[model samples]
Target: MSDTSDRLLGETTNERRASCQVAPGLTFTKIESTLQDGQTRYVRVLSVDFAAFTGKIRATTGKTVKDRERTSDMAGLMASQGLEPLAAVNGGFFDIASEFSPGALGGLTVADGKILNSAANGEAALTLGNHGTNLWIDKVWSQSRITFTPPGGSPSRPDHVVDGLNREPGRIQGCGGGMGPAGENDRNSHPDNLIDARMPQLGIHCLDSDETIVFTEDFGALPFLPGTVRAVLVGADRTVKQVSDTTSGLVAGPGEHVVVATGSHAAWLQTDAVVGSQMSLPAADVRRGASAETAVYFNGTDDAVVNGGPWLVKNGAEGPFDFNSGTTPEHAYLTPMNSRTAAGITTDRKLLLVVVDKKSGPAGPAHGLTMPQLAQAMKNLGATEAVNLDGGGSSTMWVKGALANHPSDGTGEERYVGNAIVVTAK
Candidate 1:
């Protein structure tokens, strides 16, 4: 089939699959096929730049309420406005003041931040900060975005603000606060169950176990050749130990892959090449050239600024980036920024985009997208450079009422998470 035909149908015949061109400088070739439970699975060969995709997790709101019914009401409020619930509701909901709030975990909060006790266990709220921290309570008839400074000292224990959201399986591990059960020191433990941070080396089992290989990031390394491996996962730490030498070295480039072990066990393998490929608007077209200045905006305006540095807009469009209203599960109305956003500014000018897969409604699931499905969906979308962001209970993708992705967790429950990436105009 021709590229145009494939783009339209989203699939191609076996004969044409070998040389399918999804995007510029990206190609998909058939690798292998497998049948499970009477289902046929075909693995495709991917080629592209891995550095183009990066990941990030940012703290949005901190403290919130601790009311279950109020949290449920907040979910309905989000649904009515076309936003996905950020917390999970088991029997309860998330409460910002519930000792497990983001403020408790990261010691970060805004004076007039948005709060929603929409998680399963308690009430949840999301605040919008100003220059510093800001707090806002809609339920309390508050509007103006306020700002404040974070508290002085850190808390002693881990906060459980979004515990109800954490219980849901497939939810990213590190939603509510710090790395979930897997603390930062435990390599064998899961690294906060976020799609972007979900390192295969950190115990995130691949859907197609045969196609996935885990590796550590050795900054000082060369590129691995294609066709020698399937999919590759980079370690969390930015460093990798040399193959024959024990000396720790920096991975040469952002894209180079290396090998890493979890708790003395070979947890993941990495390749010094692109593990996947993606179709991005050219830097020139996106106005992300070397000379271009980076700008950030929230809610489609430049009024709400987070890190007002240089920005690389998609397709050269200033301010609001276009939404992917395409016919794919990965497509959504609002795209959240991943660590790639940070990397785009510091390293390559590439943007990591994500869509919240959940619905709005009092009767909707609270959680966002699951890990396995997200990984597979990204693969299917031809993402050569993709990483999972924080999802589940804390999986919130809100845009004034035009729902973007499907919420898998279901209604009246909110999912808690460590952080999130938001877009606001200053």
Candidate 2:
């Protein structure tokens, strides 16, 4: 075993002995946190076992070739030492390559004279343009349903929301695409509250009472939507439910307007619902007197967000919520192509989530996390379902332009994308 592995094992053994535990179900054997760049922020390395799968977490960091190779080597070393690398196939890392090009990140041509690469892999570097932006790498996914919002921008605007719900009715069971034009075509069909020139606004929040809610707006107006509204509510006990203007006694239709709700315990709200409300308050209040806008309130019942009976809330607010941190103003987000299923050796588990943050440092082969490292990072987070988010120069996450993760290209540029994930009010 390599020195690192040996030390990790020794540490695990010592921890087990000290804890005086017998047959612990799942435990962390090793944890290594480091700051690669000159910045104070560092990435965390955790070696964990869930009694089913074992892996490590890479915390938050930019992509780098050396880091990627090192991560791959580590996976190999783990396998050779009798430790199964959960997602690593045959002791080798598995990467989701872009279908747009062979071994190349997915690319797109934007309305402006710019080229956007939304499906870049961990092995590639990001390049920013004068007006171009990169995508983010942080994401959260569940079975066939996924939601991701963009990062960093003005207030009262959506980050970006993408959801993949099953469309077919038991056709393939738990297999479908995003919730929108695609979702409308699928079996798990759900109404899209907002649809217009502008994309829909997406936001998540938790009430002081320990309930989670996700909000979406109409998509008729660019930068603004009409009277459409939809929401997903979650309880403090990790129970999910749905809440909307319909349930809140608010007038629902189709037009561009802001929506707001109030609660406590900031993280209780999923994403940046606080930020979304902050943005929508003034504008929405102006459009409709305190009476009309206020009418759309969050009713106490948090059972509307439940999927199948009850499941632990997977994506909640806890990580970086603000876009205007040290990261860039642009963030890349991801969603699943379809829901997952079990088909022989291949599981239909598609990761549908969004991660948007700015490119922090310079761009090049030495930036960001490699495919292997990313997988390890997910494993460390105890993620049973995870996938590579949009990356490369198009890999950008921003809060009003404050860079987050290290940029693959040092130019501090924003790459265009087919679409983005933004957090906004109802």
Candidate 3:
């Protein structure tokens, strides 16, 4: 942003007394502004000059789908994987209830080119593909299909279609895809279920009598659910190792995954799955207004993709990014003034991460920002395009393995989040 705009925010670039360089190309700035109403707003901003930066930015999830933790935990996990965590911020919205795999990512999330979850309708995503330099903030959607090829059968025409990946069989979290024949109360049917399904009356926990769900090693262990559930262990080489109808938790080994099914879906696993046949989840099928070229690009292995919503800025302008209020029930939640986290890309091609702190207590001075306020803030901060990430108690920022923002959680502590976008030295 220009020096004049910096002055407008009550801070100047030349006088970055509250800013520090977290890494060679990453800088963190803290802004404390007092409005005309005399309310204090705390904001943290992180900028990464990917164009010349010698670092890597990636999205990561906990070891399992049900795993949730602070941004530091997610960062430390990646640290064990040989990456030097430099900075991080909480990622997408997620399921917090126990029945639907509490930490299941709410929408499409691809980390290290692996599809962790399917896309949710009326949601926007930030995709960093074609290397970290090509950052995109758009209303993108995708579909995933798992095809099982019989022994000696061609992939072009698979024998059967698997239902989902890394999620519960009958529960479609965030009211998105993975709605099997018996899956109930999803957005497709009960439109209000888009967000209201999290409530008991919406029938979201309804189980599919016949469904197939593939759980990768990232999912940790297959929980032993009630019913006549059958499972087939598939190795990293795409070979079926074993098939059984057991109600026991089976931990998938490194580079291994298990396919669990019930009812007719299980029948295919019992009868058609030859021990040495190939079972695969091909590239996610890109759809919902995305161009054919965009589909091909997204399906290919790239960098990271994180889902968010209510576009803050687009194409260097304020948003026309509307998720029809008439149909999408979650629209009402976007306008309120609340603590928020957002990811953006500047016109000069820099990655921007922002976190706005909220009121801490009853008499707290911080009141947070409304959606329009956030959009203006992003544009004022030099963002050409941006999308809001998970906020409220889930809003957090970590630098050098330490908390960098005052979270709105009443306790002022970081909340266990579903995922995170982190940076590491090259």
TM-score per candidate, chains pooled: 0.26, 0.23, 0.81
User: For all candidates, what are the clash counts?
Assistant: 118, 111, 0
| Residue 280 error, candidate 2, Å | 27
Give lDDT per model, in order.
Answer: 0.24, 0.22, 0.69
Ranking by TM-score: 3, 1, 2
Q: Over all chains combined, what TM-score does candidate 2 have?
A: 0.23
RMSD of 1: 22.3
Q: Tell me how many residue pairs clash in candidate 1.
A: 118
- Write down the lDDT that model 2 would get: 0.22
> Which prediction has the highest TM-score against the true structure?
3
Q: Write the per-residue lDDT of candidate 3 for residues 16-114, one digit (tens) a residue.
A: 227789887899988766556666677889998876678788888877766788888999988998889899999987776656467777677888878
lDDT (Cα, 0-100) at 109 in candidate 3: 82
